[model samples]
Target: MSYADFARSIGLGGIAVDDPDKLGDAWGVALAADVPTVLDVRGDPEVPPIPPHATFDQIKSMTQAVLKGDPNAWHLLTEGIKTKARDILPSRR
Candidate 1:
């Protein structure tokens, strides 16, 4: 199950937010909430972790993974883009 689903199953209020604005909203809700809560910001696992000394080949493989999403892979390029956008932009009111 998804992380958010797992959290909810344990009686914690949770949200899997895909939008920047919704993320802020979820945070607010969690803050006001008396019980445990979770706000899952989806990330692309297919994108290789970028270290300071990453090689060109490593970067290329990471790019390929993003472009060709495998079901076995944990993330998608589109999700990565959306997540990055969310992080960059201010949440909606």
Candidate 2:
């Protein structure tokens, strides 16, 4: 079950947000609730979470996993590369 559903089952307030733009609003609703709240924010599963200071071993392991025929190999690799690139490259904004 989704986190929101799980939270509701446990008697807490739950807010599920699938859109990135609605995250702030979700947080607002969650914070304003009388009961404890769970803000379930959905994001792209293909995009791996890259740490700010990723180690060489970590990159190697992820690459090996992707090369081992993980179902979402292409997306995992591409998104990882993009994430790394953004870290290395200067910000345009």
Candidate 3:
């Protein structure tokens, strides 16, 4: 079951925020709630948690792991590349 479902099962208020843009609103609702609240913020699992400054060895290990037939290899690599690109490239905004 989802976190929201689980929270409701235990008789607490629950809010699920799948969109990043809705995070502030979700927090507002949670904080304003009279009872205890559960804020279930769903995020992309395929996006690897890359450090700000990854070492050459760290990158090499990740690549090797992907090459070894990880189930989510393609998604992980693509998401990682996209995330890195966003950091390296200038923002359109």
lDDT value, residue 5 of candidate 3: 74
lDDT of 2 at 22: 77
TM-score of every candidate: 0.47, 0.57, 0.54
Residue 80, model 3: lDDT of: 82
- Candidate 2's TM-score reads 0.57
Clashing pairs in 1: none
**lDDT tens digits, residues 3-70, model 2?**
99899999999889988567778999998999999998876777767788889998898799788988
Computed on alpha carbons, the lDDT of every model, listed in order, comes to: 0.67, 0.84, 0.82
The better-scoring model by lDDT among 1 and 2 is 2
Lowest lDDT 10-residue stretch of candidate 1: 43-52
Q: Pick the candidate with the highest TM-score.
A: 2
Residue 76 in candidate 3, Cα distance off native in Å: 4.9
Model 3 misses residue 26 by how many Å? 0.2
